[model samples]
Target chain A: MSGGVLYRPGDSPVHRIPPQVKLLAAFAAVLGVVATPREAFWAFGIDLFVVLAVWSVAGVPVGWFARRAVIEAPFVLLAVVLPFVSGGPRVDVLGVAVSQDGLLAGWNILAKGTLGVLIALTLAATTQPRDLVLGLQRLRAPAWFVTIATLMLRYVDVIAGELRRTRIARISRGDDPRFLWQAGAVARGAGTLFLRSYERGERVHRAMLARGWAGHMPAGPAAPVGALRWVAGGSPALVIATAWAVAAWPV
Target chain B: MTASVAMHLSDGVLDASTSVLFGAVAVAWLAVAAARGRIDVDDRTAPLAGLLAAFLFAMQLLNFPVLPGVSGHLYGGALAAILLGPWVGALCLSVVVVIQALLFADGGLTALGANMTNMALLGTAVGFAVALAARGLARRSRAGLLAVAFLAGLVSTVAASAGFVVEYAIGGQADVSLGGLAGVVIGVHAVIGIGEGVITALAVGAIVRVRPDLIYLVRTSETRELVAA
Candidate 1:
């Protein structure tokens, strides 16, 4: 079962910045990186450095962050093989036919994706989950979208825990999930889970009405965000500027 | 099918009108989910929605290699439908896609509607239907039920991918052969479908044992059966 690593309270400058600033800056940085032309290799490298600097200010443990960031490994793996796939005039690399265009495309993806993931990781590691949702809501993200996200985050663990218990029950009953031929049991398990989750949503909705819920969800007190507060709190704009300059530099 | 299948299509591939059309559909679906019955927002539902969105987001980030060259990511509609009802599942997955598009740029903003249709509406609707049919035939047999779930998940993914190919044919930016490219994309997805099916089934099976009432699709079955009896 996949679990979320929520933000723990800390005195770090990164933790003190309002969620909105982090959200905007991180998104802006990602956009900047992705929009960078194919020739901007240096710019991508500098973006990486800026992201790392954010993690440092956030007081995130490098080891723990690295482990958590491993979630991006699959995407990274895909990027690794990209240069070899799209067919073109092949360049000899260790006696292998690798497409030069594919390599460039792969590099582009790897840089942007890696930068995006890191920015996200830094944001998640430093900010509380609720704050992130709240920030999104404040930014005019749709109410329905925000509300649904809030609920999903809350109940995922409860449902996941239940799933684990059920799996154990099935295993104890001599169900060998490992056997591909015995896939029927696995299918049933999924169907059964669906039924349970559906019913739970109904039940949860009833409970809300019983407690006097209105059509729209109410937001918390708006937090005042000052420019200086954000600049010091988040990674500086100069870092991004430097990265942009590098990305624009000659190949 | 290559393992690194990009769920997000290029902007030029889908015409502007098509994107807006799908976007409207996605919005309408969410509106229906919001307007249905009790407008009361439950504490549990909201939190669960967020977490599930996160789970889906994270899982999609971890696109596993299904075979030698192809990779697949968690599309999440079928899985969400199993855990949350089709209406809510559709809403959740679409939101996830929107978030990815806006925040990550993994999916283009212009084609957001099409992505939602492929990953959320079509994926969840078809997956739920297959699961329902499977459940109907295998109501009495545990093994039969599992088979149905497996097939449902597998078929749903292929159907979703096929929908992409169709959309591409309609709004193709390149000179690639429509029928041939569509076939290739769908064929590879068929194999990737197994992994999606297994992961979805495994997740579903785990949840059902603890709180059968928590599952959206299965809950319908038990209730309907009771009503019939």
Candidate 2:
């Protein structure tokens, strides 16, 4: 189990924007992409441009973004299946009739899904995990939710390291996870790992209480978001909304 | 097997109305879970819940081979519910889902609500209930416990798939008919469900053998029976 995060450390302007604002901006951009008509291909182009502009500003490599965006491969597989199975007026392509509506639907899924993913990737690349939790806290999310999220971010890597060790130990003992017959042993290893994690949690809780931990996680220093940060953080969403409004306007 | 559950519904897959409806339902479920004190954690339970979220995240990364050229990973809803109880299980899974979407880009941001509802809310609730019912029917023998755990995993995956079908029926963007889509989705998921069941059973069985005290559902039920006696 790798760290399972995509955050890249940088001091670019995009990285300086507060995590909450970037979160909101990402949300707004996704809404814009989803709301745009599929026929408005130019709107999708504008959305991509916005994403690229952020990528460039953040100094994130396009190859890096592309590599991470492969997580959307499953959705792409679903999109490829849509054109054949979907019912619509038929269009001839390479002597085969396919649903015209399905093609549009497939394109719709591919374009919008990719855009949503790109925006999210930008957010992840620019925001640190701790800052993200802090951002949630500042946004007035529930205290318990923030605390759990904070602890989760803090310990995810630790548990992932433990998992790797467990896998290695299993392999050294002749257990192979690749064979279906070995699934029982693999799952037992997972069970042992869970029990160990449970005990570690208990011990950590005790240590925290011994050092003086109240019911709530203590608040960190207040860092106010300036208007300039909002403007910079929100530009991608602004571009996307403008593109949608323009595309939707009657000639 | 290489196949895993559709972790998240992507944008444009469903109509706006359908997304909003499912999103609202997910939010309502979260509120209910919180109101029921399921998300609440004391000092002792808080660390456990957090570590459980991390553990789930790690486990999902480890996919086990099921069929040739296909693999499956633990959704872990049944395992979590058995160990932590349903409410905390739901919360922990929700946290993992959120982090996956945000950090790993494994799920769509807009479809977060639908994903959470299907995986976290429905999976944990249905899985836990099925486990309890199966346990009751099996008379709680050692083998019976393992069998129920397997059954719980199977039912949870099927239930989550059913949830997707319902959402697709309501707000599907593609032109495919409901029956046709449901048939394929449910059929493929049934196989995945078996993998889920096997892994969940093994995990539960191992824990039960070593430290029965850590199994929350078992502990609570035994205490209830003691009170009745």
Candidate 3:
């Protein structure tokens, strides 16, 4: 449940940019990348460069993106398999037979998926978790949805700690959780965790009630976003748009 | 399991049009789930749903061995539905999907709708309906309840994978054969579904023994069965 913020503390201008703007920019960049057809290879290249430029400006290391990009590992595997199994005209690559369409398809997934992951990582790295929540709230996501997501993020660490403690106790008692034979214990442990979490929720509700809380989550006044902040946060997305425009321009 | 449990697709997996279309579907689903959560008879449903969302995220970290080298964790769609009825369960799962994409780079931000529609909507609701039907067929025994959980997990995984196929059929960017993709995806998930079934049944069985009341699926019916016994 590594739900902790990937935000790196920095004095860079990227950090100072409003999270809502950053969020919008991230979404727009991803859409820009996704919208560019696979044939529009130049737009994809520009998208990557824009993301990297922002990355360098933000001062986040390449290692961070590389490590987190492993989340895309399974998809990369899917991409690799596409060429061999895909039904299309076969093309030879270094003496190996491959589907021509599959190669392009694989490349499409690789390029766009990679850029999407990078842009997401950049936003996660530069934005605080609290600000992310605030951004969601300010963006007028359903109040209950925001509240639940915020609360879940808040308690993920706590529940994860509980999991760690439980696992430690189990290991000390000679339980190997990784093996299938011990799945019964794992399931039971999960059940126990669920029970404990549910009860904790009850206690949390009582505490909230005691503090004069209502059913509704109160959102504080949001700070205004200026034109300058939008421009600052939107620079990379602007790059993506320009690249898209160039590709779309009548030749 | 990674394909199924970590169900969110990275960006560009589906074309932008398909992503936006599914995103609209996801938003509408969330609004319905949110509205239902707010107006539910139980006042504590919201907080409970919130904590359950956290619980599912935590449970995901604990993976069980599924094969010679494969392992799978709880996808929690069926588990959530059984514990907290469909609407709240869907909302809870949606929250997890949303957060996983946002904070963690686990899913694509642009693909959020496709991910959400598939996992939160399809993965959850179908499992719940099946489990409810299974419960009726199996009647009021401990074995029956476990069977419901098993069926729920199986149906949920298969259904969710099928959903991926549907989305892929609509806007799959890959030039791969849609039929081939569907077969491979569903085949993998069927095996994954067995492991899901076992874990889900056992997990639900454990809770049924301790606190049957907490599981929304069997709460009243199970209570009635216990009294008869």
Candidate 4:
């Protein structure tokens, strides 16, 4: 639950936008970013600007976002290795000849990847988990998929809590997870936790049936987004997408 | 032992066509899985599968230290497939991947297809098949089951790395040679696979000791016996 990076309650304009529109807008922005040519460096810059604007408006601290975005560290390592290993026309930089095309490729990964992650972060920071499930349903995503997502969200916190408790119990019983021999204990704990969760799922399912739950999950009471809200929600993505399309066009 | 968790392919790493192609294939697989109704609300399987997804999500967050400053998390595709069968396992992993991308920003949205293909499709499918084959050859003894689980994890990680090489060959943004790239990727992943194998084997072994009937692989064996009868 501590890792609930998906949503933070807020009253910003971005937060007020309907979840479906936000979802669509986020998807559109990502498509625009991915579709843009890597050579269009200016396009990426503008994309970054748009993302930053959203961040500022949302009032999320730069540090908060930056810390979570550090998940990209591994990819950054791979990107750094690209220039030396990848072959192409070489250029001298800092007394070393590196592949020009590979340098561009690495920049492409870093720039576009950062923007994509930021946009996704914006979406997550605004929308609640429950709203996201409802948004998917409203967007005509498969009913079963939505149902499973809803159920999974409900129990993810519970299972995570159970994991923490089990870890504490193990530690209290002289089990050290850091030791190699304790690997078996840790894994066995995971298995035991999973089995308990599975049994709980069975009981939960039976309870749902007892409470008259049918195959279809009942829709939430949130109203669908109106056309005005759609335009408002989609405007940022539209602006970014147009910039991408223009930059991607042949000269 | 440095156990590197499976890395998410970032955006711009693959050409648009390659990403789209993989994305389409992944969606089709999901459709097939859905149509098969393997994860449908059957009063038992659906809730169990949903909980499995949540449990995997939580477990993935736990990074155990393997060496000095190097830690590894459970990939869990093999473990999921062994417990829930392939279709349900793939679906569960897919759910976890989607949530990670949408909620946590852990993986790129455009690269979701590649991630799912590597972790969900190839990892689970290859791991499950290899485990089943090994079980058949080893007479399904408890020790054999654990060994097979280990092999499944080891092989699946390498197989997913191979899949990455193929994808890179098709639409690699870098000008790196396929042979060199594949060598590096596979070699590194093979070592990481040892950790994957150990975790998967011990986890599966633990369940076998307590509730063998709950395991999908064990259930399949019982069904085979019933059909023979």
Fnat of the models, one by one?
A: 0.16, 0.65, 0.71, 0.62
| Runs with alpha carbons beyond 4 Å of true place in candidate 4 | A1-3, B1-6, B41-43, B137-139, B220-229
Ranking by lDDT: 3, 4, 2, 1
Tens-digit lDDT string for candidate 4 (A20-79) = 899999988887888889888888888888888888888888787888787777778777
Question: After best superposition, candidate 3 residue A132: deviation in angstroms?
Answer: 1.1
What is the C-alpha lDDT profile of model 3 across B1-229, one tens digit per residue? Answer: 4455227788877888999999999988877876765534444666667788889988876667765476877788888888887888899888888877887887899889988887888878898899888777535799988888988988898888888888888888667777777888889888788778778888888898898877888768767455323
lDDT of 2 by residue, B58-111 (tens): 788787887567676788877887777788888888888887788877677778
**B-chain TM-score, every candidate?**
0.83, 0.90, 0.90, 0.91
Q: Write the per-residue lDDT of candidate 3 for residues A1-251, one digit (tens) a residue.
A: 24456778897988988888989999998998888878888788788888878988989988889988888887888788878877778999999999898888888889989999999988888888778878888787766676677778878789888988987898899976555555788788888889999888888877877887656567787689989889888988988988877877777
RMSD of 3: 3.0
Ranking by TM-score: 4, 2, 3, 1
Compute each candidate's TM-score over C-alphas.
0.69, 0.94, 0.94, 0.94
The residue-by-residue lDDT of candidate 1 on A131-153, one tens digit each, is: 77788888876676777766765
Q: What TM-score quantifies how close candidate 4 is to the native fold? A: 0.94
* Local lDDT at A13 for model 4: 96
lDDT of 2 by residue, A30-96 (tens): 8788878889998998899888988999999999989878878888887888889889799987898
Compose the digit string of candidate 1's lDDT tens values, residues B122-164.
8888988888776765355556655666677788888888878
Model 3 residue B178 CA deviation (Å) reads: 2.1
Q: What TM-score does chain A reach in every model? A: 0.84, 0.92, 0.92, 0.94
lDDT by residue (B1-229, candidate 4, tens digit) is 2323235777777777788888898889887876675455354456667788888888887877676466888888788888877888888888888778788877788888888898888888898899788767424598888888889889888887788888889977789888888888899989888888889889888988887777777666766354223
Q: What CAPRI-style quality would you assign to candidate 3? A: medium
